[model samples]
Target chain A: MSMTHWQAAFAARIARDEPQWLAPMRAAAMTSFNALGFPTTALEDWNYTSLSSIAEVPFTVGASASSTTVADLTPYMINAEWPTIVLLNGSYSPSLSSLDSIPAGMLVMDLAQATREQPALMQQHFGTVATSEHAMTSMNTGLMQDGVFVHVPKHVESETPIHILHVSDAAAAMSAKFPRTLIVAEAFAKATVLESFVGMADVAYFTNHVAEVVVGEHATITHTKIQRESDLATHVSTTEVHQARNSHYVNFSMAMGSKLSRTNVYTVLDGDGGGVTLNGLYLGKGTQHTDHQTRIEHAQPNCFSRELYKGVLDDASHAVFNGKVYVHPIAQKTDGKQSNHTLLLSPDARIDTKPQLEIFADDVRCTHGATVGRMDEAGLFYMKSRGVPAETARRLLTYAFAADVLETIENETVKQALEQLTLERYAGSGNNTAHAAREH
Target chain B: MLEISNLTATAGEKDILKGINLTVNAGEVHAIMGPNGSGKSTLAQVLAGHPSYEVTGGTVHFEGEDLLELEPEERAHKGVFLAFQYPIEIPGVSNAYFLRSAYNAMRVARGGEEVDPMEFLDVMEEKLKIVEMDDAMLARSVNMGFSGGEKKRNEILQMAVLEPKLAILDETDSGLDIDALRVVAEGVNKLRRPDNAAIVVTHYQRLLNYIIPDFVHVLAGGRIIRSGGKELALELEEKGYDWLLQEALA
Candidate 1:
């Protein structure tokens, strides 16, 4: 389809019953999307990732979400009782969501419901943290229908985490889903939110997702996004965060599926004494292409940011990691460090890692480094000499390379689940070699 | 238990071991004392199937099985171990974890039931004492950030756990303090049995004082130039190898 057709479909989707406040925002975003269109390989950011495959598919848009049952969602759920909110084809499914366990004064509702009931709150923060800088973000903002809206009131610490599950069923094949999530945490509040994107079938589809997070003063938020789409799917997600004074935010993204996937995590430390950590782990196999682009803007003084992304590519897979840390002139005492390391298991596997640091402050301390290497031959031979089979040795070393990123996760339950997944993906071959060793 | 007839090998374009012949019987510890660049370590590596060395001409038999035809892990499973001159560090894999995996792999390959973690821990504790290693070392990454003595001790600890029939110590005494040398030699001495043997390759005879080899061979120019009893090691220690090389040339 051409850009005009995409714009016409967006206009038809927005002509329905949307609030008056969202009308102008949608119009501006639609104009931006029209002007930008789909990014091409000519752009520096998209130079390594091609969108020709995604653009060739005639995706059906503006359709009602396919009906999905609980059985179809069980495979994607990490915790079934964690005040879960499920989105089918980017639209909220009340039959699948279970929000009864949510704490009092903590609001968790669908985006459409929030626009109707909490219009004031939605109007103030929506489309504020995330700008229409990229075509995917603009298209998602203009075309989004329903996603979860979470608001943790001031000083209301949520003990149980909130699970936002996105499942695209078999009926969603040859279609597009734009998922939008906005999370606002009030002052002195603490919460952990996990967003999981999964697909139920082997059909090809496109997922354009955007999430805006606002962290209030002295608040803390732990956000995790796990992208396990179908092997033939295209996934593009952008997480834009704004942190307040003395607030802390950390994001952990794990990408293991999708034939073509790109995730951009951008954060701005707008308040003094704030800190942010963007850590990611990507495992690519079987000709898959995974890209992670992150930027941390230290806009305030006395802020610290750390970013570490590790990738393991096998077979003919390719991975790209581009991370930058930007510090403003007035942001003195800014401590920023970023590094990207990749391990290529096969000679055909490739990785392009670039760690950049742009600092205007003279007194700030910033450092960036990147390394791309193959498996350690000496280490492999050492293991085999100790009686470990060649295949098992490779699995153990691969798992070890990806295990340190799991340490970045603070939640034990989520950490364990991801640990098991990593083990099964890398080390478990009929027998659990590394898992059995860790059982002691 | 082990025989190598006319073994010739090369590393890269250089001949490392040329026309070497040796025989190791059960319950015997043979000391191979050689000068620098004399193929002592190469012989040990070839016996354990180090891929760096290409065996151009050799026939090695271990308990009547063709040792040269097996891979490194298969050689390990058949009770052959080589204590590396410099053990490589494997980050993120704990010492205990590596040992357990290696132990279980050998057991499973031999058609035996795998020992559980608890059972393995019991066996590990017994072997750890032989190397005088603390429990904290077991949890650390293999050979990473370890002291020189600690690395050698870890090698011995593995040998103790694996219980190989033929243990080739390649310069095991290099870069060791007097106390560490004694401890390493004592660990090797304690693990010796009537049915298993060892080949100690070193530059000096200081290690043989504790391990007490039954025979000593002087290797020069990729061949065994001389062979004698353990007293030959002491004589070489006092007289040095210059006279021996001159006598062999004469």
Candidate 2:
């Protein structure tokens, strides 16, 4: 079958028995997806990562069960403090999840259940943040069957983080899992949510996911998305965040997984004094490829946005970071800064970074910078002279290099945990700590 | 405790130290006075096994062991300390953390027990008082954005913590005022024990007034040309190295 046949098949599957309001929206999204097709390197946004692997996957959309359990995916769940909500093959599995101390007025249930019980609220926010412009997001909306829904009432604050663990374990079946997460924080509310993606070992699968977050007026939200999939899997993730007046949002993305992965993070400051921070760290090893395309729009005046993304590329892996900040003509007093830095660990590794600022306002402070280089030899030698093994010395120096970005994380425990994990990965990639100190 | 015989060192084919011979015994303080490029700092770095300097035809013995055969950190673990002229700035590494790591590395080398965090903090607090440094500096990254006097005081603080047997101070008195000079000298004097020795490498007699030395030697062109009592430092300060060089050549 041709590409148009696959698109038609996806649209036909979603049109049957769907809600009347969502049916027309799904058809519109399918038309946009057909027009866009799959983005190629000719497009500046998809320059480094290719979509051939995702396009070639032979699969059908729907929720299906597999034999994999939570015990089999324990190593990927790095954060044990947060209660886990495991999703097997795109459907929520309560038997494999542990939710004990959730706050009052907060909902963590399946998307279908939320739609059935609170149709009005679900209809108001679902598919609102993720528009129909992007093709992958359209594909996700066209094929999504089951996902996680979270809602926090006005003025309620959650003390602990909410974790949604999405695992694709359909090893025997050729399938595509589209896990959707919709989070709405009411006015004056505070919450933190983490989404982690995992897959079965040695499995060939495709995952198209979307997470839409809506922050009400004067609310605060902190979100983290960690994607670590099987080496043979192909994945595409898109996060759409909308902020109201005087609200604050912080989103951190760490992508260190999959054979081919592309993530799009777009934020809109819809009201005045709304602020956002987008920070990311990506690690690409072997022949893996990763790309991140982010957009932050200052629709109203007096809004502030800052973005910093860093990557460490080794072997023949490639990484791309494209960030754009747009300020409306009347959005005066806007402050925006975007910086992307990459550390090339091997001669064959590659990185492409572009920081674009389109400010129509006359009075604004906007700046961007990009840097890509090797490690500092002087810093390495200084550590080695202190009897730290050369391998350990390099590790310590690299840790220091990345510490500037990691230290900005407000939570000390999370910051330290990620630092330790990054160090272990650095060690596993042949840092040679045994002979580091011998040179001194 | 240490002996250097016919030592010659060079940097980039330029001779810095030429045929120098000196002996430092236990319970003694030897002060080497010289002008700029008189090889005072080169001697200390050579003894500490700095990589930039090439030692040609030199025999260094520390407590009857071949000192040149070991690395700089090994020399440090063997009770030899060099107070650097310029302490390096290590960002993201705390002062207390770096000191504890160095202390434990030394302790492990000598088959001694490592100090826990509480014990280490206690020892650090007690030693910090001698150098007049507050606990706030210990909490910060090592030597980052520190003043000249503060950096010098931090070096003395590290010495007090390590408690090395042989200490070499190279130009430690150059960037200090009167008050800082007295505090640094007092800290050094407090670290001195009967079994420990120190080599004060300087170009002026001002430091010797604060910390008295048993012997004062004149080093010119990498070799010691004159040896005298503590009064020799006074003579060199009265008439600069130019007068001494003229007399030695004559």
Error of 2 at A323 (Å): 3.0
For candidate 2, give the DockQ.
0.18
TM-score of every candidate relative to the true structure: 0.96, 0.86
Instruction: Name model 2 segments beyond 4 Å from true.
Output: A1-12, A59-64, A70-83, A169-175, A199-204, A314-317, A341-350, A371-378, A381-385, A426-440, B1-69, B113-115, B174-178, B201-206, B214-232, B235-250
Tens digits of lDDT, candidate 2, A1-440: 43665675675677557677777777787777777877777776776777865675567665454677667867756565567788887777888887776777788878878888878889999989998377788877876777888899999998677889888765524667888999999999998888888766667677889999999999988888878777777889999999999999998888888888888889999999999999988888999888898999999999999899988888999988999899999889999989998988899999988788898999999999999989766555444344334565566555555555665666555666566656667745443232121111
Per-residue lDDT of candidate 1, residues A195-306 (tens digit): 9998888978889999999999999989999999999999999999999999999999999989999999999999999999999999999999999999899999999998
Look at candidate 2 and give me any clashing residue pairs. A389-A436, A389-A437, A390-A436, A390-A437, A391-A433
**Most DockQ-accurate candidate:** 1
* TM-score of chain A in every predicted structure: 0.97, 0.92
Task: Give the CAPRI class of candidate 2.
Answer: incorrect
